[model samples]
Target: MYLNQHEIKSLLNKSFDNFVDFVNTLPDIRFTASPYGKWSAGQQLDHLTKSIRPISSALGFPKVTLRYFGISQRPSRSFDQLVTDYQRVLNGGFKTTRAYMPGVIYPSQRPALLQNFLLQKNKLTVKLLGWSEKDLDKYRLPHPLLGKITVREMLYYIAHHNEHHLAKLKDQELQGYTWQNQLQQLIF
Candidate 1:
């Protein structure tokens, strides 16, 4: 589906709101528990937070380092590291949370994490509202697994990724399976 600025912004806002609502309903125990064996609630939050860092950085302002290094040649970095770096940048005033991903760090101080996640999501919605069609077309960064992709593509993938996780989270909630229990079932 093609999206103009207004449409994109609307989608972003709605998605952000939906995410906040979902998180708000989650009990603290669930937030800390891993739905699956591989990732804790905290780790998933870290992963989502990491995923958006490059996209926001690429789109919000051009980085001379990126230009100089080129997309393909940029240093290999772990997603977790990038997320942490983005957080640091936010704290330092180099970037705002508004441009970051829309999820809270799992197992964090619940109130603050939720507050920050919602705040950042709102900021990102505003940023999306300001984007031009041309901006969407611009290549943001290279994915470690998928190679180069545009801002629009990244946005689509981000939504899909969130949906995938949300589905899993829902399953965990409905089944009432803890991380260890899920692992035990898989082993059997």
Candidate 2:
């Protein structure tokens, strides 16, 4: 669906708010814990950080690649690793591009890795708001996994991804509480 700037901004704001709420609900320790064997909290945050990079780039000025991650082989790097690597690079004023081709790796990480995920998310939201409809369409990018996604699709995926993770985190929280209650009754 094609979203006007206002609609995109609203969705981005809401999505970011939901992500913040989800993060707040977690215990500090859980920030380092992997909800599943596959991904840690830090990794998830890192993923979010990297996810916004393309949007940020698109919003900054006119570019060939819009609404999608750049046309690079770096898809092999998980968003988490890229965040960690990029965080360091960003700190030093040195930007690094992905070294490999797209679709080569499964991205994963712990939450502690991305301290500014929410902030970056907000920046991206603002960026989306400034985009013209034509720019959004012109920069239609393809996802290695999803394939040929428009800018609107990319925005939807951002919110959808956050929601998917939030649900997983909530499930983990509920399961922990249930387990704790069961253990308490047994101990008592």
Candidate 3:
């Protein structure tokens, strides 16, 4: 779906805010624990900050410079389609590149990382508001995993990506939810 600037802004704020709130409620140990050897919540937040920083910075570039990445000739994918495409890639075992990885986000780094995440998110929103609805569809950005996607699609991904990580964090809680419960649900 083609999201207008207003819709984009609202989704962006909602996703980031929800993630931050959830993280804030975590005790320091839980925040930094790597459940089932997956990334800790702190690492996930750091990764999100790293991923979003580039998009926010790129959006500040002049339109002409932004077009250096090339403009899209086709329509932007609906938000749902983009999310599905991302899921498909993930299911295909397309791992994140080192560039976007967060090595070791210590508990002490949590505040800085969260602050940076908010900064990037706010900058992206402001930059997006500066754009015309037409330009959003006209411009393209290079997505590391999805190749070139329209600006609007990038924004859609940003909104969903935040939620994606939150879900991963929640999934950790289910690790010890008990085999009996898992089997009962499957049997039912």
Candidate 4:
């Protein structure tokens, strides 16, 4: 339900670790593979990196300055509530905006991609930890799709957002996978 900073950080760290593990399972060639006109697995990873790094900087902005941007803070939402709301947004066809898109070119090296993902996640976790408990429920930022949410909800969203992308990646490949085949291929 309500997420304290330690619980939030632990959730993010676990989610990131799970994601990196998933990334390692994909064949190197699949990194660049995509349906006719879509982002490759590599590009999806880069897109996530692009999306989260800016939030780290956004967190650094003084509260008064953020308020000046006209994004008013809302009451903090529960973690479970955010997960449910996020799923609705996903099913509602919320798309990543053009500005958040990664460049067409992507790193071919799997290790490099993993490293980059881990680094950005670490940066985000550090930023999240730097906040006081009151700040978590006080400060707010404009989420591209969801608009203004408190810092706690934003962290909750970040954990779920990464899971969403990985699900999308799996969906793109599920066309060819039987349940057993998928189990054999997906290492968890």
Candidate 5:
């Protein structure tokens, strides 16, 4: 479904807040625990924060600057189309680069990570507010995974992204139960 800027803003605010609360609720050990050698909860948050920096910078840029960067003049895709496009990229095996991965931050640094997350998230929200919905629909912003997209699409991702990560974290939370559950399934 499509979300206007206001709807997107609300969802983004709620999702990020909820995600942070979820992280805070985790046991100390869960911060660093890699359920299956995949990203730990902390690493996932770190990656998301890093991923947002470029978008924040882009949001700060003037339209002229975007022009210099050769912002796409392609037709603005609908919000759902933008999300579907990103999903396709993931299904196509688009992995985040190593530089974007978490390092030297985990259980011991949870506070720092959470603080940074708030800082970056705040910047993104403010920058987004600077644009009109039409402006958001008109200008193209480069996304690390989604390539060039209208600002509206960017916000769409911003709105939905944390929920995606939150689901992953929940799966990780349940990771230790898998083996026991499997045994029960077999016994049944």
Candidate 6:
């Protein structure tokens, strides 16, 4: 529920580490293969890197500048609540915005993508540690899908978001399952 910076950091590290380990082990062909025209593992990694870069950059800004977004009026949501909200949105057919989408990621880019993701993740961890627990709950950041959420909630979302993509990548059954097929099945 209430995760202090250290706890949040640990969760973030574990999720990211697990996701990276799984992805790194995939063969070049597997990494580049876009199952059913969806994102390939490399594309997912690229998307993740794109998603995290901004959070780390934003956190480095002075607290005064962050106030431009204002503070949270209510308490931060628990991790489960945030995940549930995210899942509900996903189920409702929420698609990622253009800025967060990944381009065609080549297998050759895996190492660089991993390196960049680690850099962004580490910066985020450091920035998070720089804040007090109270400040974490007090400050707000605008998330495209979740709207304005507290810093803590954002961390929770990051952790779960990494796991979410990891699960998708790991699902062998997803290889041939396309959204269009799912929709066609529903139509008939």
Best by lDDT: 3
Put down candidate 4 lDDT per residue, 1-188, tens digits, no spaces: 99898998898898878778877777754566554467767888888877787777787777677665454346688998988987888689987898788665444666777788898888888777678888778777778878778878888988888887888777766753556535544642
Tell me the spans in candidate 6 whose CA falls farther than 4 Å from its real position.
173-188
Most accurate candidate by TM-score: 3
Per-prediction backbone clash count: 0, 11, 2, 0, 0, 0
3 versus 6: better TM-score goes to: 3
Instruction: Give the 10-residue window scoring lowest on summed lDDT in candidate 3.
Output: 179-188
lDDT scores in order: 0.54, 0.55, 0.87, 0.76, 0.77, 0.86
The TM-score of predicted model 6 comes to 0.91
lDDT of 3 at 40: 86
Alpha-carbon TM-score of each model against the true structure: 0.63, 0.62, 0.91, 0.83, 0.86, 0.91
* C-alpha RMSD between model 1 and the true structure: 10.5
Candidate 3: deviation at residue 4, Å? 1.0
For candidate 6, the per-residue lDDT at 57 reads 90
Report the C-alpha lDDT of model 1 over 1-188, residue by residue, as the tens digit: 55556765666566556665776687666676654554544445555555655555555665444453343323323333433443454456552234333344445566665565555555566666556666555435565444465555556555555555566566767776656766654654
Q: Tens digits of per-residue lDDT for model 5 on 114-186?
A: 9988887888888878888777767887777876778778877876777788988988777657885356435
Report clash pairs, candidate 3.
1-78, 1-79
**Regions more than 4 Å wrong, model 2:** 35-38, 64-115, 178-188
Better of 1 and 5 by TM-score: 5
Error of 4 at 49 (Å): 0.6
Name the TM-score of candidate 1.
Answer: 0.63
For model 6, residues 1-188, the per-residue Cα lDDT tens digits are 77888999999999989989998788776687776677888988899988988888988999989898898799988888999999998999989999999998887899999999888889988888789999888999899988989989999999999999999988843543567545644553
